[model samples]
Target: MKINLAALQIASVLALGGCTVLPPQPAPAPRGGTATPAPKPQLPAPPPRPAPPQPQAPRADAANWRDLPQTPGSWTYSAESSGSAVRFGQPGAGPLLAIRCDRTRPAIIVQRAGFGTGTVPATITTSSTLRRLTATPTASAAQNAAVAFEITFAVRDPLLDAIAFSRGRFMLEMGGAQTLVLPVWSEVGRVIEDCR
Candidate 1:
């Protein structure tokens, strides 16, 4: 019986040794050979960037008063209890030039809007006459104006008539301001006539 048992154990051991377990092997690569690493899981492309903005050029400044274009405005008149005024500019804008009358003193005040200090010479040139006058810093008279030079004329001054009756137009000039080529309009005559 002992011999039979020992023979049985030996047979079991031989069977187990012949049927030993082994890890599973991978399948052989395809015939194409250069196994393309399974196209790495494709990802979406990033968005494109925008172009940079361009810079703008600066505008050129006018060298002198004559380089400026002629102002396309006309004279307008208004009356107040203190006096009457004839202004030269656009209807809704401030006047570039103004002739104000003071009823109490009975004088004509000619003002030109500009920038300067102290007294300077102002000229008004007509076809027949050219009058040069001193324009002092007269900011008090021109309320709401930035800076102005003004000259006073008596109501009977002949310069008023020359300005009113000049041939078609007249020119006003100052040292540091644009020249104004103003038309000889009836408004100027009316102001003169009313002041007198």
Candidate 2:
């Protein structure tokens, strides 16, 4: 009546192997309704990112109140013949620029010492104004007081007044020549008044 233990264990294992196991299933939906899905576990949200930087306007420089692009150099201004003519230059050098009054013609003649061929445009810049005028080569070096070019303006030209009353200084740009930044002085106003 005694049974083999090994054989009995093997028979029980073979019997259980034939059966299948599965996870629990969800219930069917009711008539005319959809089945809802199972809920999922929730997770915490991540930290927020920083905002981008905004553009800012430029700040004013107190040290350079004038806001000049280039610093001007020291110059000397002299009026000759009671403002009939004015010259601007270094104290010890010949005149770099001159403005003369032609009383007979009632015109103002501006002259610069530079070498250029033919006629060219001269650009004048002041704090609040800019003007471009035609400059013709002087007919004779000796006749123009050794100047190479000249710009003639009517006695009542507004540019004359602008140069006289310019802020601190005015700039003169000639083609193929060095630019000159001349200081505004009493001589400039005097010449304008005399010409007018």
Candidate 3:
């Protein structure tokens, strides 16, 4: 008997379409046939890891540090050093600085921070305290220096060079406060910061 070529080709094309070409496989003879199990895949080993570079601690900027937030009725102050602390509070980071100068306190206490960073740099700060132009025959200005009060702050950090301040002997100049700034410097110390 001759097989039909058309039938054979149609069966082959249908098989190529992913349909099973044969019927369900029957069980092997119970008495004698041996079956080989499929092999397991062997994964490639991961490449060896390169040695990690040495870890270094991040350098902190002292003058750039910030401390506590401002409280109402109290002046805010911050230093450039991490080691620096104010009687009022700690130093912190900010462009606009706020310093509370106790009218009763004689000297600026925060200078201690500048000293620790090395010899604190000298600075020229101006005050807006109104000063009379001295009683002059031809002068219209006041006799006393009537200008807004501004004081200089020596600094170890260039970032804290400019000062923000409030003046009071328990009484404060609510709106108009003086500002201070430091001269250009070579180096500013690292500011201490709180992690928590």
Candidate 4:
């Protein structure tokens, strides 16, 4: 009744010699044994912090249209930065450039106009600055005095921020990680050419 093979190879070599895969031995510095201070280089826990670079779309300035301006004012301005929404208007005579991109983020605007029999009104033009700032997207022809405009700004889901501040444009928060483009019209964006 004691053939030993039934002992399952001596109980599997005494349970594999008391189970030892060896990798957890840090408890022998007591009983007045003093020297146990060399285990603090565990920085592999910092690779989980790579999600802060999702803040793109702010590195652009290749527009110098001779630095923009030569009178086109009677202005109105409003500001909101990051979450985007702004309003501005300029009209002192012959033509005008009024903007209100009410924020679902679809924007670009430039102005300084009158084309056919021009005199002194035409220095810049860019469009789609909406907030109902429309004149029939050009009621007759794409007349201009000077121009440079772009579009793709949208408001219905503009990456979504509560329907883009409810189409009234709000959310340009400033401070920390730093982001602000409320140029409200930077000194009239050189006199109305690029509405950055």
Candidate 5:
């Protein structure tokens, strides 16, 4: 019998083809038990912080005059030829109240145009002091045109200077029940000092 080379090659190829490739498999479970689960990742915690401080409310009757809001009738100051004039209301145009002071004289002028004319009782109060006075209206051509009547009262130099420099609510009570509060700021002290 003669052996064929082609028959031998075909037999080798068929023998190799009989072996098949397979995918990888997981490890088999342990005897009588399931596989363990993988662990989850965790982040580190942040450090704790302290709380901020809270602001306290101001007490009643406290010297909080600087914190008060400026109204239309608040006191304002201006330089004059003789001295300084601390006024309330529109300057130059017509002021409701004006305190004109010089080295020689001190006068408190209250406009009687909007306020009723004649003798009116008025009180000025500060943080610690109270001054009661009477305002008498006088007629002048200048006063009549602008304020109708001008109420004039003489004020002492020392008292006027003290009031201008004080840091408190300088309240003026007039017209029976009407009250006007003027918050005296630090700038007012500078103005009064410069005038002197």
Candidate 6:
């Protein structure tokens, strides 16, 4: 029938505490006003990678030349009216190098593709010895219509000896560039002997 005053006071205090209001939020800026942009995060740059190594051409040295591996079935021999010729290439194929011998004339001829018209001075090195030679591009003809160049030199005993009997490399330099390295084998020596 009767309420406690202290309990009523406590209930009133609890109800007022529950109705407490939060602080008011700030108003949005006007449409014409410029807003400050947040700062962007920074990142470090990636490290650079190293370049790959390039392939190198073989060096012109006696050890490298003399130690050339023999290409099986590359040397060939043929008969001619002047004398016998030794053809260096695969069997039943066009010759790369032809050593022609005759009582009247003796010479070594080298043939390669992609030669333009003109004469190119060249060097033939056997071991440490070197011989200067001339290379002439083959003429365009109906019978031999190939774009190629050839180097022909008269056979020299010293050059042959160094190529056939020495422990050195043999290289052909043309157009100021070393283009070919010749391999010497026992058969090469035999062919040279027969020509002699």
Which number leads on TM-score?
Answer: 1
Tens-place lDDT digits, model 5, residues 86-193: 666654665555655554545544443434445667656566566776655454334334334444545544545556655555666554333556666654554445
Per-residue lDDT of model 3, residues 1-196, tens digit only: 1478888988899888886577877567557666665578989999999999897422112222122122322223344332333322234532222232222332222321111211222222212222111111212224442222233223422223322221211111111222222221121211211100
lDDT of 2 by residue, 15-113 (tens): 998776877888988789888888888888988988987864221212232354432434344445544787766567767788888787778898886
lDDT of 4: 0.34
TM per candidate comes to 0.60, 0.56, 0.19, 0.21, 0.45, 0.51
Better candidate number, 2 or 3, judged by lDDT: 2
- Kindly list the per-residue Cα lDDT of model 1 for residues 1-196, writing each as its tens digit: 9999999999999999989888886666789785555457878888887888686321121223233445689888999787899999987888889988888898998898776666777787766677777888765434444477888999999888988898777778776567787888898988888889
Residue 79 displacement in candidate 1 (angstroms): 0.5
* Alpha carbon lDDT of each predicted model: 0.78, 0.72, 0.29, 0.34, 0.56, 0.62
Q: Candidate 1 local accuracy as lDDT?
A: 0.78
Residue 108 in model 2: lDDT: 89
Off by over 4 Å in 4: 1-69, 72-74, 78-95, 111-137, 141-196
**Top model by lDDT, which number?**
1
Q: What TM-score number comes out for model 2?
A: 0.56
Over all chains combined, what TM-score does candidate 4 have? 0.21
Instruction: Write model 4 residue lDDT over 58-98, tens digit each, in one string.
Output: 32122432133333334454454522223333444433333
* Per-residue alpha-carbon lDDT of candidate 6 for residues 1-196, written as tens digits (9 for 90 to 100): 1468888888999999999998986566669996556578988888888888887654444446545544333556666677666666667776666655654656655555434456777767776577786777777634434455676545666777777765634666676333656566666676566556
Which of candidates 4 and 5 reaches a greater TM-score? 5
The global Cα lDDT (0 to 1) of model 2 is 0.72
Q: Candidate 1 deviates by what RMSD?
A: 20.7
